[model samples]
Target: MQNSNLNLARKWRSKNFDQIIGQDLVVRILKNSLYLNQFFPVYLFSGQRGCGKTSTARIFATALNCEKLAEFQKNPKTEFPCFQCASCIAMQNSKHPDFIEMDAASHTGVDNVRNIIEFSTLMPVLGKKKIYLIDEAHMLSKAAFNAFLKILEEPPISVIFILATTDVEKIIDTVRSRCFQLIFSALPNDSLVDHLSKICEKENIEFERDGLELIVNESEGSARDAINLMEQVRFSAEKITKSNVQKNLGHPDDEKILMLFAKLSQKVEISNLLGYLSEISFYELSATFIWGQILKLSRVAIYLKYGVIFRTNFDLEKISEIIKIVNVKHLINVMEIFCNYEQVFAKTSNKNILLETLFFKILDHSNKIEVKTSSLIKEPEKKSSETVPWATFLQKVEALNDPLVFSVFKRAKFINAESDKVIISFFKNYEFLLSILNDTRTVWSLILEEIFKTKNLETQIVEKEKVIEQPKADIEVEIHKAEPVLEPLKKNFKSFQNSKVDVSDKDKWKLANYLLESFPGDLIEVKE
Candidate 1:
C-alpha cells in the first residue's frame, strides 16, 4: 500500500544521478568526474526551482563517500554509491555526520559563515569526504559572503562545498570564481509528463492523458509542482478527467476560452460578448488568467499562420477559426493591448468591467485591420510611412515670419493631432496667445490650413486655469491672516496630474499613428 501521508514530490525525489530528470549534461559531467576521480573543492549549481540541484548534490556526496567505490567503478553500468554502502545508507537516512545541508535563507549572517568555516576545518568523521550543501546561497549577506571568500579560495582537500541558488548572479564574483559551475534547466513538458506518468503508475493513480497534460501545463516545467498537482487531482476523483481537473483547479475550460476568442474575433456585440464572458465566470477565471489565455491563443495563431505547428492541447480548429478572421497583426495588437493593461487587470477589483473594457478595446483594434475573408491568406503588409516630425504646426507658424504669433504659439503644448483636428493646450499664463488668435482667427486658421492641406485639419485650443484647490487654511492662518505656503504644493500636484494624463494620451496617439501607417487608408480613430 502507498504511504498516504507522504507527498509525491518528496517520496519520488531522485535518489541517484541516474534517477535525475532532464539534466543530462550535468549528470554526464558529474559521472565522468567521479569515474576519473577528479573532485573540485567547491561546486556551484544554479537553475529554477525543482530542477534537481539539491538531489544531485546529495547523490554526488553519497558517491564520494561510498565504501564500495572501487567495486562500483569496475562496473560502469552500476548506479552511483550502489545504495548499499554504510555511508550511502547514512546519507539516505540523514544520519551521516560528514554530510551537512544548510538553508542559507535562515542562516544568512557572518556568524553562520564562521560556524560553517569552523566545521569545514574538521576532518571527515564518518566518510571519506565531508560535504556541505548550502541551498538558496544567494540569500547570504555581503559580510557572510566576504567571510566565505578565504575558505572558498583555499578549502581543505577533504571538504567539498555545493552551493545551489535559483539566482546565480546574486553570488559574489570572488566566491563564484572559486567554484565549478553547473546550470540546471526546468524540465521540458514531455520529460515532466513522462516522469509524472511513471509516478502515477507506481502509485496506482488513474488519470486521463489530457488531464495529466493539463497538470503539466499548470506546473510550468517544475517537476515538483507537477507531481504535487497530480497528487491533488488524484484526491479529487478516482479517475482524473479534463472537467475534473478544470473544476478542481478553477481553470476556465480551454474550449470556453477558445470560443470566447472566436466570438471576439468576429466582433460580436459587447452585450452579447459580456454575456458569454459571464457564463465563464470572469471572477473565477479572473482578468489576469484570461489575459494569459489571450497571449497563448495569440501565439498559437501566429505559429499556425506561419505553417509552424507546435504541440498544443488547445483546440486547433477553434484557433484556426480565429486565425481566419484575424491575421497575425490583429492578434499582435490584441496581445499588446493586454500587455499595456496587465497591471490594471491585476489590481482592479471590478475585473468583469475591466475585462469587458478590454474586449471592446480589442474589437476596436481588430476592426482597423482589413482581414482577408479566405482561409490561410493574409493581407499584404503596407509600406511604412516616414517618421512624422513633431511640432510641425509651430514650424508652419514660424514660417509666417510673425514674431509675436511665433513666440506665443511656440509655448503651446501639442495635446493631439488628427486628420480631422489638431488640439493644443495653453496654460493660464499664456492666455495672451488665445486672445491674440481670437482677435485674428483668419491668420491662425491660415497657418494650420496650409500645414494640413491634405488632412484638412481644424485647430482647437484648450485653456488651463491655474485655479488650485488647497486644503482649508489651518485655523491659525485664518485667525492671524498668515501667508499660506500651500500654493506651490497645489501647483505641483496639478502639474503631476496633467503630466500623467499627457503621457497616457501620448501613447494612444502613437498606437493610432502606427495603425494608420500600417493600414494606409483605414480610418483609425482615437477615443478618450
Candidate 2:
C-alpha cells in the first residue's frame, strides 16, 4: 500500500509502462524490447526533469527482476510487472537490495563509482538480475566515469545499468557511445491536464478547469511540476480556483492580463496604463509572466488571422475583439519586440518602470504602424518625377572620379526629396562621412541638379540621433589624474656646455650664420 501522506507527485508516479503519460512511442519500443527479452545491459535515459526517465528506469528494473515476469510472458495477457510479486513490491517500496540506486550528484567521486563497480561484481542476492539506477549521471566526475567505464563495458551476466540524466551533452562521449540511448520528451499540455484531472478525481479534490489550465501553463510541460503546483494550491485553499492558482503562483489574474492586452490593442495612454499597473501588486505581476501572456495572445491572434485553428482557452468574443484590432503582421511585430526585451526585463532592477516603458513602446509602435497603414490606404499616388531613384544616383556617384565621396554616399540613406533640397541621413557613427560630404555639398548639389534637370537643388546631410546609456551608480570607475613631470634642466644644460663650439656643430653653425646674416658683423672672440 502507498503512503497516504506522500506528496501528490510521489504518490502518483507511474509504476508501470502503461501508466506513463505523453511518451507513447518510447513506451512502445521499451515494451516490445521487454516482451522479447532483447533488452541491452547498459541503457541511457535522458531528457528534461520529471519526464519519466527515473520512473521508466525503475519500472524496467522491476519488470526485469519480477518473479512473475516469466508467468506473464507465457500467458501474453499482461506485459507489465505483476505488482503482487516480492520483487515488484520491494521495488515499489524502494527496499529491494538488488535494485540499487545512486545519485551521481552527491557521489561524484571515483571512490563512489568504485563502490558500484565492486557491487556489480557480486551476484544478485534475491532476484535474477541486479539493476543499478544512477540519476543525474552527467554530474559524475571524469575520473569516476573512467572508473565505471570498464565495468559498464563488460559487466556481470546478471547486472544491468541504467543511467538517467537531464543533460546528456555533459556526459562523456565514450560513456554515451557504450550505452543504448533513449530520449524522453516533455508532456503536452492536454495530456498533462488530463493526468492532473485524473489525480484530482482520485484524491477527491475539487478543481476548476481554468485553474488546472493555469497550473499546466506554469509547469512548462513538466508533469512533476504540474502535480507539485496542484498539491500546493490544494493545501492553500479548500477548492482550487483560478484566482487561488494565480495567487499561489505569484502571477497576476488572467483577466487583468487580458485587459492589458485589450488596452494595448486600443492604444491606451501610457500614464493611464501605468496608473492601472500601479494599482496592482508588482510582486504578483512578474515581467516574465506578463510577457508570456502577451506572447500567447499575440500568437493566438496571428493564428486566427492566418486561418489557423488555435485554442487560447480565453473567451471567443475576447479573442475576436483582439484579432479585429491587430493583424497578423502587427502581432508578429509585437511578439518580436517582447522577445528581444525578455532578457532586459528579467535583469532590470526596476521592473515596474521597465514594464511601463515597454507598454509605451508597444503603443507607440502600434500607433505608427496604424497611421502609416491608414495613410497608405488614403493617400493618392505621386508623379514619377517627385520620387528620386537614390540607387541610380549612388551608381552614378560611384562611376565618378571621387571614390571616397561615393563610399560615404553608400552608407547614407535617402530621406526625401524637396522642391529645393534632397535630404539624406547618416548614422551617428558615420558623422565624419557626413561632415566630409557636407564640405563638398555644392558638388553633390550641382550633380543632382544636372541629373534631375533642375536648378537650386541643395544637398543636405543629417546625422541620426542615438540613445546613450547613463553610467550605473553601482559601478566603481577609477579615473586616473594625469600629473605633468618637470625634470631638472641642469643635465641638459651641462651637456650643451660640454659640446664643441666649432662651426662643425650644427647648432653653433646655425647661430653663427644667423649672426652674420642678421647683424652683418664678424665675430672677433667667442665665449664658451
Candidate 3:
C-alpha cells in the first residue's frame, strides 16, 4: 500500500462547503451571511480539534473568493470555491493576495502583532476584500492583544479579521464581542459510523459492523482519531473483524473481560483468578481502562441481581461464574472500591501495586456480602431460596474510599463473606492491586462497617491470628507521624520573650490594642 494513500485524513479533507459532512447549522448560517451588502469584519470560529473548524474556515474563504459564485449557484457546480478559478487556486495554495493566515501561538508577541496591523492597513491587491485569519488566537499575549485592539475595533471596509481558537475563554471579551462567533459541535455517533463505513469501502478494507461500531464508541466523537485507529487496523491486516479490531486497537474485548469477570463470579479463589489473568495477558491493557472494564462487569452483575434482564457481551461461562458468587449489593460494593482507587490512576507509577492493593482490600472487606436469601435466621425459610446474604472476609487490610479498591473488586472473580469476615478475589493482581494498597492512604475498615450496616447487621474486623513476639535490636532512626515537626509550633508559648528584633511604632500600637482586647491592659504615662 502506498504511504500517501494510507492516511485517510489527507485524502478526505473537505474542500467545499458541500464536502463538509457535519455541521449543518454552521453551513446554513455561513451561506446565508455571505454575499450580502453588509459584511462581517470580524468572525470567530471555535471548536475541538479534528472537528472541521479549520477546514470550515478554509472552505468559507474559498467560497467568498470563488469566481463562479453566481454561475455555479445557477448550474450547481459546487457549494464552495470553483477550484479551477485563479482565486480558488491561489487560496488553495495559500498564495492569495487577499487572504493571509496566521498562527497566533507562534507569533503572539507585541512586535509580531504590530506588524500584522501594519499589513492590515494596505489595500487588497486582488479579490473583493483582504482577510486576516488567525489560528489559535487564544495564545496571543496581553500586549499583543492590546496592540490589535485598535485595528480589531476599526478595521478598513476592505479588511476582514477571522479569529479561530479552541479555548474561547482566553480571548478578551472586547475581541469576542467584535466578532460573529460560531460554535462547532461534536459529530454524532451515527454520523461518525456512517462515515467510517464509507471510508472502509473506499479503502477496500473488510471490517465487521460490530468492529466499526467499537471504533466509533472508542473514538469519542473525534473523527480524526477514528480514522487514525482505522489506519492502525488496516496497517495490521488485509482484513478486519471485531476480534481483530479489539486486538489491533488494544480494546478490552468484552470477551476477555467477560472471561475474567466470569471467573470472578465464581467463588473467590487464587487458582481461578490466576487462570483468568493469564488468559488475556497480551496488549498490556492500561491499568486505568482495565479497571474501567471491571467496573462495567460489576455493574452487569448488579443488573442480574435486580432481575433487570440485560444482555451482556460476556460469554455464558463468564455469566455462569458471576451467577455463582455475585449479588446486586456486592456488585455495588466492588464498584465503589474500584471507583475510589481510579482517582489516582493518572499519578501512580506502579499500576501493579495499585491493582494488588485493590484485590487485597476487597478480600479484607467483602467478608459479609448480602444476597437475595430469605432463609436467614431472622427471615423465614421461604425467603432463603429467593436470595441469600453472604459475607467474604480475608486476612489483609483494605482501603475504605479508594477507586482501586472498587476496581479490583469490580474485576473480582468472586467475593464471599463469612459471618464476620470478607474475602475479595481478583482476576490478576498487577498494577491495579499494588498501587491501590501501597499508595493512597485509603482506609477500608470503615467501608466494611458501612457495607455490613446496609444489611441491617453490625460487623467488625479482628486479626485472624496472633503473632509471637521476639526481642531484637530495632532500627536507630525513628519516624513519628503525629509529632509536630515545626520548631515554633512545638510549644504553646504566648510570645517570643527573647526576641531581638525591635518593634516599630505601628507594630507596638497593634500589639498594644491586641493586649488590651485580650487582657484588659492599660498603658501607663511616662514621667520625664
Candidate 4:
C-alpha cells in the first residue's frame, strides 16, 4: 500500500519527452538523435537536483525500447514513445528488467563497479537495449571509477550507460570525456510559477498567485523544492495563503523587517529596538534576512543613482527616501560588517546577545558620525593675531617638507615656548630620538624661528638622569685587582693609541706593543 499523503511531484512526474516542462531544448536534441538512429554508448546529464535529469534518462530509455517506436520510425514524424505500449507501461512503472538504476551514492565502491561490469556483458531480457542509469555518479570512489572506466569506453553493442550528477566537477576528466554531455538548467521563476499553477488546477487544489510567488522566491530555482514546498502548504490548510507559506517556511515577518529598517534610517534609540526585538523569536535569522533585503535595496539604489532604470518590485518612493539618507559607501560598510560577523554569529551559543551587540555597534557608529558633524558646525571662529598653540604647531610640523626631521620632532613634548627660545623634552625611552633631533638642532631652529617670526629661537632638549648603583665592597676589590698594575704607563699608551685603558700601573709598554701589532693597518691611511 502507498502512503495516503500523495506526493504531487511523483504523481505528476513527466512520463515522456513531450511531457517534460522547461526542458524543450533537451527534448529536441533527443528527438533529433532518435530520428537519425544515432546514439552514444554513454550519456552524461549534469544539473541541479530535480531539474529532470533522471526523468529525461528514463524517457530516452523508453523511446529506445518501445515496440511502437519502430512503427513511428517508418512514419518519420513521431519521435516520442506511445505510452499505451507494454514496454512504455513497464518503463513507467519501473518494472522493466533491462532498465537498471544504480544510486552511486550508496554503492560507491569497486565491488559495485564490478557488479555493473559483470551485468553489462549479458543481453537485455526484455528491452532492445540494456540501459544503465547511474545517479549521483560523482560520489563513486576513485578505485570504482578506475574499474568502470574500461567498460564505459567500449560497452556491448546493445548497452547504453547514462550518468547523472549534480556536481560534474567532481567526476574525473577521463570519465567525462567518454560520454555525450547534456547540461540541464534550473527552471526559471516564470516557468516554475506556470507549472505550479497547472498542477494546482489539475489536482483541484486552491492557491493564491502571491502564495505561489513566495514559494518560487524560496525555491532558489530548484523545481523539486518548489513542488515540495507547495505540497507542504497545500496539506497544512484548506487554501494556501501568504501567511501560511511564511509560517511553514519560517520566513521573517515582512512588515517587522521593513519597520526595523525604517527605525534604523530614522535613528531610533537602540534600547527601544531591543525591546521590540525581544518580543520576536528567531532574531538572528530575522537579522540575516534584513541584511539581505538591505543589500538588495542598496544595489537597486546604486543603479538608480547611476541613471539605470532597473526593474524592481520595491516601492520607488521608499527606495528614493533610503537613497537620500544612506550613501553607497555606508551601505557597503554595513554589508561588510554583517558579512564578516555572519560566521561568528552562526557559531555562537549566545546569538541573542551577539545580535544585540551588533545592533548597538552599528547604532554607536551612526551616533558618532552625527555628533562629529554637529561639532564641526558649532566650532568657533579663530583669531589671526593670536599665536598657534603647541598642538597646532605639531600639526604644522607634520605638514613639513622634510619628513625625517618632522618624524623626530613629532615625538618630543613642548616644555615651554618663549619669544627667543623653545624648549622640548623626551621620555626616557625616546632619548635616542631626542639625541638625533639635537644633532640637527641648528637647521630645525632656523626653520622654526622663520615660522614663528622670532630671532634666535633656540630648541632645547632636557634629558633625565639615569642613575647606576655601586657594586658591593668585595666585588669592587675583585675589580680593582683585575686591572693592570702599571696604570700611569697604560694611560700614556692609551693616549697614544686613542683607546680606553684601565690599569693598576704594571707593564703598560707590553700592552701598547700588543695593540700595535694586532692593528698594524691603524698606523696607515688606506684609500679605496
Candidate 5:
C-alpha cells in the first residue's frame, strides 16, 4: 500500500543530477567524470546537514550502473540514469542488489564494518557495478574505520565505495587522502526560493513570495529543512502568508521588528518599549532570534544610509527615515553594543530583564548627544577681573616661601570668585601644572581659607582659550619688515667668517673691536 503522509523533503528528493538544486558545480564535475568513465575506488562527500550530500551520493551511484549510460554519454550530456531500465527501476524501489546503503551511526562496531568489507569483493548481481553508500561515516569507531581502511584504499574493480559525512575532520586523514573529495554546500537563497516556488506550483499550494522568503531564511540554506518547514506551514494554514507563517512558526513578523527599531530610533522611553514588547510573547520567541533580527536590520540600515539596499522585506522609505534620524555612527554604536551583550542573552535565565536593560542601553546610544570633554580639558570660565575675588592670593602664596605653589598660581589668570570657591584659567602650555596644583589643593586649603577668610575653599582649574593664529598676510608683512634688520647681520657674519684674524691674547682685542664695529650690539664681555 502507498503511504499517504510522505513529507515534502522525502517525496521531493533528487533522483538525478539535473534535479538537484544549488549544487551546479558538483553536478558538472560528476557528469564529466561519468562521461570519461573515470571512476575512483573511493569517493568522499562532505558538508553540513540537509545540503544534498547523501542524495548526490545516491544519484552518482545509480548513474554509474545505469544501463543507458553509454547512450547518455555519447551526446556530451549528463549521465543521468534512464529510469525505464530494469536497473534504474530496482534503484528507485530501493531493491537494487548491487547498491548497498548503510548508516554508520547505527552500525559503528567493527563487526558491522566486516560485513561491508565482505561485500566489497562480490560482483554485481543486478547492475554493471557494485556500490556501497555509507552515511554519517564519521560515527564509525576507530576499530571499524581501521578495519575498513585497507579495503577502502584497494577495493574490487567492480565495486565502488562512497562515504558521506557532515564533519570530514572526524574522518582519519589516511581515509581522506585516499579518496576523491566532493564538497556539498548549502543552497543559495535565490535558488532555494526558486525551488520552493516550483514545488508550491506543482503541489497546488498557495504561497506569497515574502512567506517563502521567511522559510528560506529560517532554513539557513538547507533545502530539506526549507521544504519541511514549508510543508508544516501548508498543513497548519490554508494560505501561506507572512502572518500565517509567523503564527505557525512563532517567529516575529518583519513589521513588528521594524516598528520596534523605529521606536528605538525615536528615543522612546524604556517603559513604552517594554509595554509595547508585552504584546509579544517572549515564551514563543528566543532572545537570540530577536537580537539576530535587530542586528540584520541595523546592517541593512547602515547600508541604506549610503544608498545601498539589500534583498529585505523592510520598506525602503521606512529604513531611510530611520537612517536619517540615526546616522551610521549611531547605528554602528547600537550594533557594537548589541554584539557586546549577545552572549549574555543566551546565558541569562531572566531574559526579560536583560532584554529590557538592553533596550534601554540601545535607546541611550541611538541618538546623538554632545558629551563634555574630560576633566583635563575643561572649558575655561569667562574672564572678568571685577567679578573675581582674592586678588592678593598670588602675593599670599608667594609669601608662603613655597616656590611650587607660587609658580602654579603665578601662571593662572583669575576668572571668577564665589563665596567659597575660586576659578582660574591656565595657558595651554601650563596645562600640565593643573594636575600638580589639584593634588596639593587639600594640603593648602587651610592657607587658602585664611587668605580668603572663608571657612572652606574650592579651587576650579580650566584651560585658557586657544590663541588665534596670526593671519598669513600679516605674518608675511612682519617677515618683510624683519628682513632689513637680519640682512645686515647676515652680511657682517659672512664677512667675519671670510676674514683671517690672529687669536693671540693681545690680538683678541682686535676681533672684539671688529665685532663691535660690525654689529650694532654692545660687547659686554671679552672671552680669551
Candidate 6:
C-alpha cells in the first residue's frame, strides 16, 4: 500500500454526505437533524483518530449553510458553494468567511478562545448561517472554554458551533451539557474491507483480497488506519500482497514463530529452542504474535493428548518429540509465560530486557514437571485394584465443588486411588501424574485434603509413573448417589477411550456434574 508520492487515503477521502463509510446510523441521524431544522449547537463528535470526525463536521456545516438544495442542485452556486460553486470551493479550501474552522489544540489559550467569542458579536459576512468547526476542541484551556461557554449558552441565532475531539471526557461538563453528542465508533472489518477494495479498484491500485484482508485485520477496525496502512504499503510496492503486509507490520513472522513453537513443543532441547528463538531477532517479533504462536502450540499439545485435532503450522518432525517429552499442562504453563510477556512487551520500552527475561523464564520453566512429589518427570502406570484408604479419600475429594481445583482435575481420569495415606496417584500415565504433583504442591495438598478429606495427605509424583495395577474395569470406593443419576459419562466421553471406570448412575452423576461445572457442557440428566 505504498503511495509515497501522494496520500491515497486522502485521494479516496469522503466528500458530500453520501460518501461516508461505515457510519450509516450517525449520518442518518445528522441528516435528519439538519432536514428537520432541529439545530442543536455545541456538538461533540468523538472517537479515535481518522474516523472522519472533522470531515463530517465540515460537511454538516456546508449542508447547514447552503442556501438552497433545489436551486443549488440545479445551478449549484450559493453562499454555501454546493461544491460545484465558487463558495463551495472556498469552503473546501478553508477560505470561506462564514464557515470558520478553528483548532482548539493550538489556540488553547483564553485569549485565542476569547477572540472567537468577541468576533461572534459580528454577524456572518455573507452566508445565511455562520458555522464554527472546532477540531480537537478538547484542547481548549479551562478559562478559554469557560469564556466560550457564555457564548455557547446563548449565541446569536446565526452561529453554529461544532466541537470535535477523540477524548470526550476532556471536554468540561458545562460545554457538553449544551451540545448534542454523536459517538463515532471504530469501523467494522467487513465494512472496512469492502470500502478498501472499492477504493483500491477506483484508484487503480492493485491489491490482493487476502492481502486486503490482512490490512483490514491489522487496522483493528479503524477505517482511517486501514487506509493509512494501505497507502504506506502501496507507496513502496507496485502491488499490495499478504506477504507485504506481513513484512512491514512485523506481525511475528507467523510461520517462523510457529516453527519455533512447534519445535519447542516436541521436546526440542532447551539450548536448541534458545538458538532458534535467538535467530529471529526479538525486534522482529511483536508480543501479540508471540502470544498467539505460543498459545496455539500449547493448545495443540493439549489437544493431542485429548484425542482432539492438533492443527499446527509446523512440520511433524519439529513437534512430535516435544509433545512426547512435555505434557499438556506444562505446555500450557509455558504458553502463559509468553502471553504474560507479550503484555509486558507491549507496554514497556525496555523490550530487549523484557524479552530476554521472558526467554529465560520460558527456558527455565521448560523443565517444569507437573508431578508434585519427585524430581523424575515420568508417565504413570495403571493402578492396583485393591481398595486403598486414598481411594475413599479421592471420592470424597472429587465430590466437593472446589471449582478451580476441580476444573483442572476434571481433565484427569480416575486412574487409581493410592493405597497409602502419604501419596495419591491419578492420570493413568506415570510421567503425567508426577508432573502434576511436583509442579503444583499447594494445589496438590488443597486438592487432596480439602477435596479428598485427607488433611494430612502428602503427594509423591513418580515418572514413567507406574501403571494402574488393577483388573479391567474395577471400581474402588464408589459413591452411590442418594438419587439415581443419568449416564452423562457413557453419553459423552469418547476422549477417555482408555478409561476403565464404570458408567453407572453415581459415576455418571459425578462425571456429569464435574463436566457441567468445569467445562461448558450441554449435558442433561433425567434422574426420575
- Backbone clash count for every predicted candidate, in the order shown: 0, 0, 79, 7, 0, 52
Comparing 1 with 5 on lDDT, the higher-scoring candidate is 5
Q: Tens digits of per-residue lDDT for model 1 on 130-207?
A: 999999999999999999999988999999999999999999999999999999998988888888889888998887
Error of 5 at 493 (Å): 49
Best-performing candidate as measured by TM-score: 5
For model 3, residues 1-528, the per-residue Cα lDDT tens digits are 353653787677778887676799998788766644356888999987778788888888877767877765565435456688888989877789888889998988999888888888899876777888899999999889888888888899888888888899999988888889998887787888888899889878887877777777677777888888877888897766678778876676776777665554443675556556666673366666677677877776777666565554445345645566566565676787787677676578988568756765555544554455432224543533212322232123223333444544444433355566545444332323434443322455444555543322222233334554434443233556796566654665464334233334644464444345545645664433
Clash count for candidate 1 is 0
Q: Which ranges of candidate 2 are over 4 A from the true structure? A: 327-329, 365-528
**lDDT, each prediction:** 0.79, 0.79, 0.68, 0.75, 0.80, 0.69
User: What are the clashing pairs of model 4?
Assistant: 484-504, 485-504, 485-505, 485-506, 486-505, 486-506, 487-505
lDDT of 4 by residue, 1-528 (tens): 252455988877777876787888888888888877889999999999889999899999999998877776677566569877788888877799999999999999999999999989999988789999999999999999999899999999999999999999999999999989999988888888888999999889899987888888888777788899999998898887777888887766556655555555444688877777766654546555555665566567667666687765456566666567665665555556667788897888776677667667665644333323432144775534433555565566666655656776777766666676666666665655554465556646655766665534344445666665545542323234565556454443332324444442435443344345444533333333
Superposed Cα deviation of residue 337, candidate 4 (Å)? 0.9
lDDT at 175, model 4: 95
Task: Please list the residue runs of candidate 3 whose C-alpha ends up more than 4 Å from where it truly belongs after superposition.
Answer: 1-6, 35-38, 70-78, 264-267, 297-325, 363-528
lDDT of 6 by residue, 158-216 (tens): 88888999899999999999888999888877788899999888889899987888888
Task: List the lowest-lDDT window of 10 residues for candidate 1.
Answer: 494-503
Check candidate 1 and list the clashing pairs.
Answer: none
- lDDT per residue for candidate 5 within 235-330, as digits (tens), equals 999988888888877778777888888877666787888788887765457666678878888898888888886877667787787668776777
Q: Which 10 consecutive positions of candidate 3 have the poorest summed lDDT?
A: 386-395
Please list all clashing residue pairs in model 2, or write none if there are none. none
Q: Lowest-lDDT window of 10 residues in candidate 2?
A: 367-376
| Cα lDDT tens digits for candidate 2, 1-528 | 557978888899898888999989888788777667787889999999889999998988898888877776667567568888888888878899999999999999999988888878899987999999999999999999888888888889999999999999999999998899999999999999999999999999999988899889888889999999999999999888889998898887767888888777667677777777777765456777777788888787777777787877666567777668665666776787787778888898987678777678877843433332432144775546544566667767877866556777888766677666666666766655555565567656666776654444334445666666546663456789999999877754432234334444544465465445545655554335
What's the TM-score of every candidate structure?
Answer: 0.68, 0.69, 0.62, 0.68, 0.70, 0.61
How much does candidate 3 score in TM-score? 0.62
The alpha-carbon root-mean-square deviation between model 1 and the true structure, to one decimal in Å, is 17.3
